[model samples]
Target: MNCADMLNNLDSSIDTLHTRTKLSEVILKKGISKKDELIEYLRAELSEAFDCRVGFWLQGSRKSHTLIKPVDKNSSYDIDVGVYLFFDAEDEGLSASEIKSTLKYALASYCEINDEPTLQDSKNACEGLKYSAFLTIDTPIYYIAHDNATPMLATDSGWVDSDPKAIQKWLTDAQDTDDKRALMKRIVRYLKAWINVKWNGTEHKKIPSLAINILVARHLKQFEREDDSFIHSTLSICEELEGFFKVENPLNGQDILTLTYEAEVFAHEKLTELKAACLEANDASELQKCLIFSRLFEHYFPQIELSAFNRISGLPVTVTVPELTINHYDKDDKHIRTLNINEVTVKKGESLTFSITNKAHFNQYCSAHWTVRNIGSQANDANDIGHKVVSSITESHQRGAAYTGSHTIECMIFNGATVVGANCIKVTVKPAFPVLRRKKIFKGFRR
Candidate 1:
């Protein structure tokens, strides 16, 4: 591929990597539902405890949909939820510690009632609820001024001016008139993913997401090519920061980076690394560019197949196995020919066998690994779909006798971690027949 075509393909791959799939969307929806439930519980409890109304709102990257999934599966993703107390601090004689303590008490009660683990008080700003090893919800207590609706976060020092709503609005407004806003957001996600990869399993101080957002929004410029735009915008931000590193809160123009000197240094170092990588990628040959990108992005960037790259570079491709086919079998050991439409139907509790065969030239070797996944259903229990590996074929059975639903079954053939070929078949499962008691009649004595 030419430079433009290669860069275009890389951009497309980045977009695919960043786009949230339907399953992921469903998972996030479930997470938000739980967050909403907890928020409601806390609101009621705090209202009862303080004898006043309490309001809540969402903030941060989760609210903006710019959150990047962590490279490591065990890494934590946070959703920020703000609880606003609708009473004057002066009237209640409430201090920041008091507010934090009250909110912690309410959350503790909530955890007890729901049979969940107790929330941890960070004591810096927010209380954390660990939903899973990979997910957390950070609830920050805020007090609303009686005279106005100004929001203030309860910190150890005192009430600090915090306007998450205004900041979120500013971010939204920054992209309002820009035609390349979508691409801008995608680039931001890419940058965040890069950060995650760069800082994985390290104790190094990382750049705050808000600070990154602020820098990108302030310095990002549009270009005809996405690669050029990403490179130029990133370099611009880095170079600008060399003089002085400061990111202001969009709402009040207060410097948010003043207290984060270590993070600023970290950002500079990472950006410098990125600059070097971009330079290398720009100077490398077409086939080498792919390798450069793969190194820069690690596993997140899809690697170009060696065969394809060899072909492009005028080298003889050695792979003889060029075609893969999937065959399905029924319960009676009968081969069921898959139609061109690629759809399958089975009764509940029936087992289906799938085999992948490779068409190869003489004296060529081929190997394959199989993976099956349910695409649309919420109940993704492993026990519901049991699979056993027998030789090269995989036999998967739907064990749920009463289950009736349509779910997409995706069968993939992998050459190591890279997907070589794949097939998706929509499986419609019919409900099992209800058992009925037969009326018994004696042969000689009729009823």
Candidate 2:
């Protein structure tokens, strides 16, 4: 394999391991739904308890889709929810501490009434709701400015002006304007996953998610090639970190390095290690590069069996091809048709499943790799276009609604370490059908 193919394989492997599986996605959605319900209940309860208006919105990695699964299955996940109390402090003679106390009281009352666990002690910025050992919600109380609609957090010191929405808006705008934003997000997740995998049991403060986002957004260098861009952006940020370890808040231009000196030192050291790994991978052979990446990513990287190939022989090996089949399904979970040709047309939101059958009579092994590439006229990054699920020799993918144009799904069957057979199918996805609501009719009462 050449450099491009090697990099493609690496990218696919990382995506397959790092991206959330369909079941995990469903679980996450359910968690978010429960959190949303809790937030709504809190809004109403606080309003009733304090005799003031209250509202809330989400502001964190949850909104940005950069959240990664916990490295350990038992580890906890947190969602940051900002609760806004819409009342003037001076007019109502309410202090920051008073507001926080009132909010806590309301939350406690809510827990008691709902027969749920009470929140723990309030942190410097927020109060935590412990749903389980593996899930928690952090709600920070804020006051909305009547004049300008700015949000001020209730802190121990005093009410401090802070608008998380501003940062969210900045990220949204940056992603919308840059064509390479999807790649940037993936790189961010990769870095986060690396941190998770490497420092699973370490006591040092895990790098803040916001800090990684800021660094990636500020230092990412766009390139024509996806792998080149990933390497360039990661190396660029790592090099910059060698000079200093401060991450500026995009909203207020303030340094948010709250970690201790020892933590900072450890962060710099880890970044250096990452930089070295990237450099080594850049200079190594294709297979060697894959091994280096596997080391860097550790358990999060999928394992590829390479013992069947002999490095000492240094001779070409012929492999047998495996029989492949493609099955298509509609949104309603009904089978649309079985595809025999290399091309098919379907509406958006349709699903496709690919399966492989080992045809070798004996003494052969089969492993399959699948990838989908956007062949449309206006393709951004093909890897970022659709969602795929890879399970052993079988792979499944669903066409996204926004992905209208053309795409090609390719499957390569490997007999041991050698590519034995390859096949691709072209997909022409038409626009999704729009929902239409029936007009309501009213009976006339006129005489």
- The C-alpha RMSD of each candidate to the native structure, in angstroms, is 9.8, 11.7
Best by TM-score: 1
TM-scores of all models?
Answer: 0.65, 0.64
Which lDDT tens digits does candidate 2 get at residues 162-269?
888888777767664556677667777778878876666778887888888888888777776555666678898898878877888877877766788888888888
Residue pairs with backbone atoms closer than 3 Å in model 1 (clashes): none
Q: What count of clashes does model 1 give?
A: 0
User: Which runs of model 2 end up more than 4 angstroms from their true locations?
Assistant: 1-15, 20-23, 113-121, 175-178, 308-447
Please tell me which predicted candidate would have the highest lDDT against the true structure: 2
Model 1 TM-score (2 dp): 0.65
lDDT per residue (tens digit) for residues 206-297 in model 1: 66778777777877778776666777777778787777777778777777665455656676787788887777665667665654554455
Q: Tell me the lDDT of model 1 at 424.
A: 45
Cα-based lDDT for every prediction: 0.60, 0.65
